[model samples]
Target chain A: MSEKHLQTGDALPPFGGKLRLFAMRFCPYAERSVLVLNAKNIPYDLVFINLDQKPEWIFNFSPRGAVPALEYEQGKGIFDSNVINVYLDEKYPEVPLQAADPLRRAQDKLIVENFSAAQSAYYTAAFNAQALQPSHLENYHKGLELLQKELETRGTKFLHGDQAGLVDYTLWPFLERFEALPLLGKSEYAIDKSKYDILLTYMESMKQVPAVKTYYLSADMHAKFTESRVKGDPNYNMLDSSAEVCCFRPRKKKE
Target chain B: MSEKHLQTGDALPPFGGKLRLFAMRFCPYAERSVLVLNAKNIPYDLVFINLDQKPEWIFNFSPRGAVPALEYEQGKGIFDSNVINVYLDEKYPEVPLQAADPLRRAQDKLIVENFSAAQSAYYTAAFNAQALQPSHLENYHKGLELLQKELETRGTKFLHGDQAGLVDYTLWPFLERFEALPLLGKSEYAIDKSKYDILLTYMESMKQVPAVKTYYLSADMHAKFTESRVKGDPNYNMLDSSAEVCCFRPRKKKE
Candidate 1:
């Protein structure tokens, strides 16, 4: 019975080593990490993990069993996307992801937390409407409404002050997914360009933020995400993500 | 709107320059930051946040609203215990909280993620029961069983390597809470000390670690937590630590 271990007693990986991003594009959690990578000019080998039938190593490696995990050559892999975002900003300070000041960092943290946490209702409501399991709709909608009101208030170019700082990069890419989803047939929940002009404007601005603009999701990866996979394969988690598993539940077989 | 911004143009706060830890002793999320503090030996002023009536400043300053938030000075604050843990470890590298080797770090991330996450389910089972609500009791218990099984297979002293590294520090304290619980009526749910001798022994050994022995939770803070108001407070994201909230839903007064 051999146990696997990462020997710290050995040689170190090079500085400009392979950085792996394991995620599904539509996933806001994964997107947060992507936004930072785009915000930073970090080159990475993108491994689209099949999240449904997750590989043993992924589950073995990621204790929480979530996506947007990163494998950095120099240190341990980052599990939480929020955690990864901060790490990306700190490790690669060249581009600067977080605001220089600490108070603003707190504000940015608030926004990121809201983005990751608050909008669950909207996702729950719409997620599997086709499947009809009744996920977290009421709570999800309430969260979105609260967010919409906050979006109304900010009315800025980003979540933090007028500029995109750690929080904006931490949260915006995830919002774009919200932007695309139909919010319970409500003609949208938050960024409506009318009231939250700044929210939409900021998103447009985010697209132009050099590194963010260059952030890419290949067609093949996108295709892989939506495609169903053979059951019991370790790579299933990667493919499982393509089903948009987080925002909703699954449809009956052959849906 | 006299909005306080930190990064772009706002000035950093002057207070807490010596390092201030806003944490609760029993909280696993808060412990992540504490572990970094202990490992780094960064002297700090512990501001025990009232989890129930969480001081308005926590929500006002921190959007998600929680403790384990770090204030370096009056002007700066870092939120998200998980992120703060990584930040503290990196900024104060006297005793690093992360693995120096990349692969090991990735593996450590997995162990931490799994353990922390399972702890969440475990807490959910207990707290949900306390609230007299239906819970994922089976699933939560299953997670515990899985954790116990994993520990049986993993090494003796610490996770991944010999000494107590990041993974060890992040989880040891959390498990301590479960071990110390009253078990109420669920005897089977109670951790059978004999079943996992390695874990029990390791936990005992961990108590001897300088960082572990030096750990202290203020008595006043404990009163706030074991009480109600644990729900949705900024102090507990219910995400960072394997956390769950319990409360005797609002009661009607005999007015």
Candidate 2:
């Protein structure tokens, strides 16, 4: 878990009092941690977590059985995606989540709120067969459209504004699937590559951040997990699913 | 909003002030803030949140339409139950969520994760109309039985150990519902007031916490919310089927 010894797959000595990331690439939740550490230029070792056959350490570590946990110096474990994100921000105030203005800081929380609990409906639609249903697609598109609208007007180059702040970095990875819903079937608001130009630009800029680039999309992940739903079709689980397939499984997003 | 005027019913004056917890009786999340605040002993205003109509100011502060938000006068305002809970604990590290031992704290997060997130199915089963269904009820009881069984060998009084900390306080009110649940529907293994003497004693001990007794389960709350949920033919909000006629709703136990 030491920053000095990065994810080079060496002897894998004990994390000598360094930050460690507990994650699986396919999981949107775990991906956020990678983005944060990458964004802040915080060096940490990445411990790959296998969800189907979990690592023994993760069981007691991740109570809810999810990936993307953070271990700070041996055992300062913080679960619940948002909690760890803010903890990293607060603990390392150099990259802060809030602004000098209290109201603006509170506003940052609203952005995270949409991504976390409020987005439940969107994910529900995305996950279920309902994404194929015409009316349901409308709702899914509507939710993304609403987010885009919010970001365009009030949001910044990043989610908080100007700089890529905590909420922005945290949510960008999860939003990669916005276009996939329509692929499952079809939708009124098409978001393949055309409709969401700003969103696309935003995503690209977010990815370009050194830390984000280092951890995600290009991490040279050890093993890619493919659930039964995402069996051997190259069309499925590819990196470009956001611009292609609509009905992608969790594993699909990882690719 | 001002810790000085928690009961004053005014938004915390814009000048960054302090954290005031406007809470309702039996709200577990509010208990989270209060416990952390007391443990940290951070000076805060503990006011009674009026849940009946939901005071207008609260809506302005939290648009998601929920309570357990810390309209921070000193720090930035934070809403959402879980986010605020971790924020307070991290910000004021007097009584850190992670116990002195690193692994201990990590395990605490596990307790929160499993109980907080995993138990949602049980909550839905117990409260939702599905709870009325035989299958859902069966799953619901099964989840509870699993939790109760886990509690059997954990530690001393609380979920972690002798110390009644965050994880224990967070779930106290909702677990009390377990006590009330068996009473409501004569379930085979839902929460027998007699069967689990340990949990019952903890419930009693938890209610005795000054913050718990004074702020959370105060005298008028029974008249305000619970009386309606558990009481004598109270007016039910048929509009929200989720709003049962029963005399409960222990501060949503955070859906």
Candidate 3:
């Protein structure tokens, strides 16, 4: 999967008959479906698109040109991260990611719903610092505390019993990005080891999971990308080594 | 089943060992779950609550005291309309409301998601008239047109085939209320017969469904309630005939 984001005027790659996911490299929502696909061991192609300069064909897959649209068939698509994730889980029931009990499923959704405020607070702190408030920090901490309490109550290695499930994958992307907050000068958003011992341990275990490990970006890397996004010009191709070939030519001559 | 909404002073009603739904009389989100329960023929208790002056115990059922909270088991509650509706459908699968195919279920969700703009537009037009824009009206028609086209494509008596299923029940509440917009002096929001021929037919079919017929209020009734709400004093017990007995005492003497 290339980190290079296809933008406007870019031709869509020919369909190779496997499931395709339209995504942005740094988007947490898109990362959700990616983690789910990996966890389910579903063979799929990832097409990273520049959200700012979205490809025309992207609209064919997603009405709003949003990322994480799954091209289940050659031209047919399903948009929204949650919609895509749930569909994938149900379609490929061989590796079920949801609880069999309906009430448990509802509770899992509630956890994600409850954590939404923290996600919003993170966005405001990272991109729109002018809107940052004490309440945002309070809500963010509240979300973390709630998750910690839930983890303690569940008393499992992961939220999904022994193995991480849809709930874990749905939230893991946000948790992964929260580590970058302190690095981005929002120290108040830090997941302190003292306060979040259990949560931090759970997060660490999540990192080691093959699905997350394959796509996880470090806090420093996320911080760097966030800095670029905050500066108005998002460096969508920051990790594209092929794009660095031109820059490396002079360094090679110097060496 | 009382139209009378329970307020802050109301005592906790004893659990009758049945599924209990906490809801407001006019809340569309709450109505979604109510319709599902009715459709599934689930033995349940409906506890109407005053949204403005909510009962203290509502928070026990819903974290934020939002309506459509389901006490699935004794003291154990699940909130959010979609969450509750889906839970009910899954828990009571003897009368499955969702599509058997996972992809179709995803599509059903997408239709509801796409129609949300129109729902928001209806809110602005009804309560916050100053915020109403031409785009809102356009989006409203677009939603209707989209639904009409979907009906044409599906060629089904209802969105959920011959029977009104989860998708129909999920969206019917808003459609029911939209009829009141014109009555509330927002003629631009009317679902014109010519424009939405198929959708209008679908709406007619939905109204006859046992689930909706039992809980639906007419456009005039909805308009009256909206007027009360907009005037800052909602007549929550307008339908409670027992409360009307006191006013009828003088008239009874005249008779």
For every model in order, the fraction of real contacts preserved is 0.12, 0.12, 0.91
Tens-digit per-residue lDDT, A1-255, candidate 2? 222211222333476577878775566787777777777777787776545445456644555556777777675466766667756765676766556554465556666665454245445544444434555555545556656776799757766678777767667665654444345342543465677777777777877767666654432221122222334422222333333443444333322
Candidate number achieving the greatest DockQ relative to the actual structure: 3
Q: Which one wins on TM-score?
A: 3
* Candidate 2 TM-score, true structure as reference: 0.62
lDDT of 3 by residue, A54-137 (tens): 899999888889989999999999999999999999999999999989988999999999999999998898888889999999
Interface RMSD, per-candidate values to 1 decimal: 5.0, 5.4, 0.4
Which runs of model 1 end up more than 4 angstroms from their true locations?
A: A1-25, A30-110, A128-170, A181-184, A188-198, A208-255, B1-17, B58-61, B130-156, B160-163, B216-255
- Worst lDDT run of 10 residues, candidate 1 chain A, spans A1-10
Better candidate by DockQ, 1 or 3: 3
State the lDDT of candidate 3 residue by residue for B8-30, as single tens digits: 89987899999999988888999
Give, for candidate 2 chain A, the lowest lDDT window spanning 10 residues.
Answer: A219-228
Model 3 chain A weakest lDDT span, ten residues long: A246-255
| Per-prediction TM-score to the true structure, in the order listed | 0.61, 0.62, 0.96
Reference contact recovery of candidate 3: 0.91
Q: In angstroms, give how far residue A85 of model 1 lies from its true place.
A: 6.8
Cα miss at A228, model 1 (Å)? 14
Reference-based lDDT, residue B31, model 2:
62
